[model samples]
Target: MTEESSDFKFNYFFGLVNLVAVFLIVWFLWYIFMNPNTVMKLYTPMYGFSLIVVFLSGIILMAKVLKWPAWYNRLFQKDKPITKGILLTIIAFLLMIGLNYIVFWGFIGKFGIAYFSPDSIVASGGIGAEPFVARENASTAIVYFFTAFLWMALFWDLGFGRWPWQNDTYGVQAWSKLFAILFFVVLFYILLFHSHVCYLFYPAQDKAAVTPWWEELAGTGSAFFSLGLILCTLVWIVFSDLLWEGKPWNRYEVDGESTFGKGFVVFFSTLTFGIILIFILLMIFNYVWMEPFVGGQYTDGPDWRYIHAGEIAGFFILAAFIWKNYFNNFPNLDSLWLRALIRSIIAVVLGLLIYWFYYSPLATFFLAKVEGFAQPGDTPLVWALLFLSIILVQSEFFDGWPLKRKK
Candidate 1:
């Protein structure tokens, strides 16, 4: 094969391997920790440990194996890919593990802010009945933060051409991306703390049962944190495929070429479309299945299970689309539109299959194997979201960090 074709094959091989490995890791961890009997045996250490592995593996894959940017060369002053990959993986493992402990346990859990609210944890079906591992507690917060950061880095910074700012001088693009990240952080802060928009979906409860901290914040604590989780997952669904590989909508004339008007139109339009699609799917599922079972007493309040199911379907649909668009490991056809149509059909089929398997077999297995684990709850989705987040971080940030390809 030619050099370009060889590189493509190598990338495809590694990508498939990585996807399988991620799936196995997520499954194993869920099986182990979600099991109430054996959960206490390895809950804390294994949780953070697995994250370290995932994060380090992704960073190493992007920095060393892909070698997309030249800066990773400085990590170990190495010429060999395997050498670089191993060395960087070790370094990242250590750094992430240390940071995970400090941030998740030492600071956030001890202080009880952001996603560590005590009451919120219990409300969402507590994990281990322990303060640290409970829902919306330190461990979950750590995972959610990692996912949210990836969403910000990928969708806003890299995918939308906010990073490597188009208008900046040659040396200033890196700084521009940093500023963009800071801008996103500020925006997240505003959404979580300052605005009532997120509450529209999450819906604040009465302060009677809330903790003092939550009450002080006008009962928005749970909604605030839950909004972060939901937004990250939603953004992943909307942008992960299109940003990295697919071209369902022609958002730009060329790769990495987007003006403010173009970027705004593309970003909002795609997001709105994804949201509407998900809403419709949720409504259908609710009407067809949920309403009949519950005697037509379906409340209009937010049903998190349906929301999580819709997000999972969105993720799978995008996955199928990307598999066809970027990695057409199938027979190639002459017509592009025909190929896209086939891919769209594949997406719908895959989405339905995923919905069926997750709610049926996966749910039954988890409920049978793990006591106190809510299969219909957000825990499983959170784990899946974290996995996708690592992929985004690897693809969008480390793969192209500190450098933008010049067309």
Candidate 2:
């Protein structure tokens, strides 16, 4: 084989090995910190997972969206990839911890809203006094907000591609984009999830927030509808970028640059595609499991079904990322559409494999999860997102170290 071919095989082999290594590392951490059977179970899967996702989202904003690390890269210009990655990871974790605990739970919860503080929620009486219930509820609201934050971040990156700030200095650009993203995150949270979250507690805080408007259509007031849609939206967003290479979306760019029109097009199209995906996945779920009925819980429930669809989408997101990073996004066909189609198929197949493995008997034993689908208090997202976080950290923070070729 040629030198180029030999190197490709070597890189591919190591990349796959690294993928397994990263996952084992993450799994070890998860079992220790977030495992259900563990004494320090921290919180319910949802609560712990939400906090993790929020931290991961913050890292994505700093590392990828705002590209803040690029600015810092100059300062650490002489550092190796591993050193830079370690330092950046440490700083980012500390920053997120402060923001999550000190700012939100500490200051905001103390001086502003009661819901931000689990203690305050617990102290308020009623359902809040219930064990673990208050923290779950608090996390539910927090995750909803950050979920919107993540969607906006991905959307902005995919659609806008740094427009308006593309020419600005790193400091100006990063902070400006940060503010812009936060503005939308808060706006979307209020319009979409705040009402549902307010109603999550007993004697719903109707005065604090409005009733969910999508309750009738979505079969419940739960924000999982929003979460489902957002997660599905994310699948398409990442798929477009990685699998399709931004085919149709990039085609809409004006003068070879991202414009308002292009961004808006990507925004609506992906969401529309997301809705379709939810429909299709739900239909598929019906054949595999019992039909969802009203007032049903878990597997036969509508609310969980919505979020479950998103959970499946999360797998696709992870698979796409893995494919792009590890396997060189294989099947380098000549036809663009054909290549995209094959890549899509590969991603979906791989996603389904992950879905199976996650819920498998072996996985159930290790994860401390009860055997069966849609068990109460069990979500694959925690695992999926955890895995995705590690992948992102490897690629973005570590610059694919050990696998990345140097200039």
Candidate 3:
């Protein structure tokens, strides 16, 4: 055989090996996530992921995106990207667990409010096997909604360089900010506090009929409430960043060029479009994937299956964005459309591999090897919310990890 031919074969073999290694790593991470014991032991993946997301979002928003103060930047910012990422991730993880134990467990759970509760017979199999429960209350719901609003405001309104305080000087633009705040407050108030307004037309099924109006409205455990929160979070995740931009309605600028009336029109129009898009996506997911696997009644119950799918979808999108933005569309050897097509094909292939491995016996083998707490029928839905949250913070606030390039 010729030396050139031998070198060609060696290169091809190594390329195939590298591809297989990437697939294995991705599958392994997904397996660990789905393992019940791993989630049960380490404060649940929901809490773990949430801590990282919240911490990164808060730090990036205050220090980098907003550039609030010099001191704030000094405290969080690092010259080395690797060091910065690692330090921020570690600090956020420790802080979230510590604060939850102190504030949510010790204070709120103990005295102020019934925020955390010991698992009951229904949630836990029995007395001794109970896990820590994060209880929902009116106050907790309000706080959650408020944080959700902040997440939206940072990404949709402020990140896009839109109204109110975007370029305000001497309080001229103050009205726009105030109006924006009031509009969101009123909008979310109805969505979170008066959800029955929307659900009144639909048939009362599952817990909606027997549950009290207040509980149905504010209860975190309620399926409708959880669904609403997930939908709203998706507005920021899937819709606002991906679908809402570059449209004709979003053309209006807020930097003294566009009038308040125009800003109001753009805001409402884009928001309406986003909500409609969310409805269609949810309907398709629910009818096609969720209802088939979980039965209609349970599908409509807490709807965790759909929520998990949405989170996975969001992660997929984020991975694409990171590939496109952070890595500058790898291979860099084709037109934009061709590159996008290639990236998408890779994503779909990888996604299918993940699904196959997750259902395969390898997942069971890994689960058996690891011994941790296990909760039956409990899915890490909060992880989805936190995933969306961190993506928004990264894309909008930090632009992207390792490098601060705008999306």
Instruction: Estimate every model's Cα lDDT from 0 to 1.
Output: 0.44, 0.82, 0.41
In terms of lDDT, which candidate is strongest?
2
Residue 258 displacement (Å), model 1? 2.9
lDDT of 2: 0.82
lDDT of 3 by residue, 65-163 (tens): 344333333566533444554445455556555645555456644664332322221232332222432322222333344444444444444234434
Q: Over all chains combined, what TM-score does candidate 3 have?
A: 0.53
Q: On residues 1-407, what C-alpha lDDT tens digit does candidate 1 reach at each position?
A: 22222333334555556566656665665566454445543334325434643464345333323332445555444335445444554655565655565554456545654343334444555333445445323344454454444445545432455333566653465555555654774555444432332222233322312332332332223333333334434443443343223354345535647455555655665556655655565567568455322122223223343434445554564455335323432324555456555655565566566556555656556433322212322244444444454444434343311121213
Give model 2's TM-score versus the native structure: 0.94
Model 1 pairs whose backbones collide:
none
Best by TM-score: 2
Give the number of colliding residue pairs in candidate 2.
0
Best first by TM-score, ranked: 2, 1, 3
Global CA lDDT computed for model 3: 0.41
